[model samples]
Target: MAIDGFTTCLWFDGQAEEAAHHYLSIFKNSQLGHIVRYNEAGPGTPGAVMAVEFVLDGQKFMGLNGGPQFTFSEAVSFQVRCADQEEVDYYWDRLTDGGEEGQCGWLKDKYGVSWQVFPTELLKLVTDADPAKAKRVTEAMYPMHKIDLAALRKAHAGER
Candidate 1:
């Protein structure tokens, strides 16, 4: 019973391998892991990909070709804690390719996985002890697709 970490499982219709590769391309410190394929079990096409294991940014994930019974929603999202605006932009641009952007630094990738890409500074600004500053920063975030750290800072400072 040595649980060091948890592996997130992503359910896909039939694109587990493709999804794994797509994620691997985005993260620099990532690599492919084991790939399991269906055989005579007959759940999926014989020889078709059943699951793919991959590590992205040191976190383990599994993509399962579990058919179309389930889907990803905004309720569950991966948060990318960026060091600065540049990191935020990098992730936002890459993840939003062939995907949809949502308000407040959220986006759904081509594989329909939701992600929150925001600067780490956002947490500090929005949690400031000054209630008005915190409120302003949070309000400024509402209309943003990709977070603008400078804008958030301005809002936090009550600058026009």
Candidate 2:
């Protein structure tokens, strides 16, 4: 496929190929592109995978085996907007396998890449015109590792 927009590059110590495969298995609209290997390059063993390109849900990403000097941090994260609770649960469960859960629907995948997975309604609830309603929804989300859409809706509606 022709990549038209900016492609995200993930820096990995030596798991470029493995990470690409992991993502492929999770996203339905995904496919593997090219696998670039080192050729006589002194930095890595010849024929070893240097980088892997893949598409996840139409977004292009490249996994680079750039060594251990660089690592993924919370400074940057990808957000997954789910249509409903089931979508949120699917991503949260898969991405958090052998990984960590952060407050407010944030998580670090097994590869250390941070992600924000939540229902699409969250944006609407948190930004509601009614300040109190929005505040309640935001408060309810504060302590959650995986967002619960029903709970958030109840908070927005001022329900006990």
Candidate 3:
């Protein structure tokens, strides 16, 4: 079989359809796909969502309304690279609606999904050819709860 992109399967207690709709609204290129329901061979009640396929920014994911046995954690996260500080701030504010914020540009969404909203320029500066500048960028990045591209650039340039 030819292997293409892998679909991330998320197990929810009973909010698969709602979550799918919410995600589709957030991302630019997203839509809900096939929603399979249970008949008799599945777990939980007989008419629940067995699987709901959704596409977010061209990435496909499958949500299963399985009984609550496991949950999402910070171990896995999705990163959104933004062109500027405004873009970063926009996503950060929207994604952390009902979730906690972590250090270094990381935030949890209302669904408990971890997300990293970062500026594209920050990555470029961190990977610059100058090792000392890169080190400065690294140091600046460590103490930040939310990523500030201007601060990172100042640090990279050996400024206060």
Clash counts for all predictions: 0, 0, 0
What's the lDDT for all of these models?
A: 0.95, 0.95, 0.88
124: Cα error in model 2, Å: 0.5
Q: Which digits, one per residue and each the tens of the lDDT, describe model 1 over residues 1-160?
A: 8987999999999999999999999998999999998999877789999999999999999999999999999999999999999999999999999999999999999989999999999999999999999999999999999999999999998996
TM-score of 3: 0.90
RMSD of each: 1.0, 2.2, 1.7
* TM-score of candidate 2 versus the correct structure, residues matched by position: 0.96
| C-alpha TM-score for every candidate | 0.96, 0.96, 0.90
- Which is superior by lDDT, 1 or 3? 1
Off by over 4 Å in 3: none
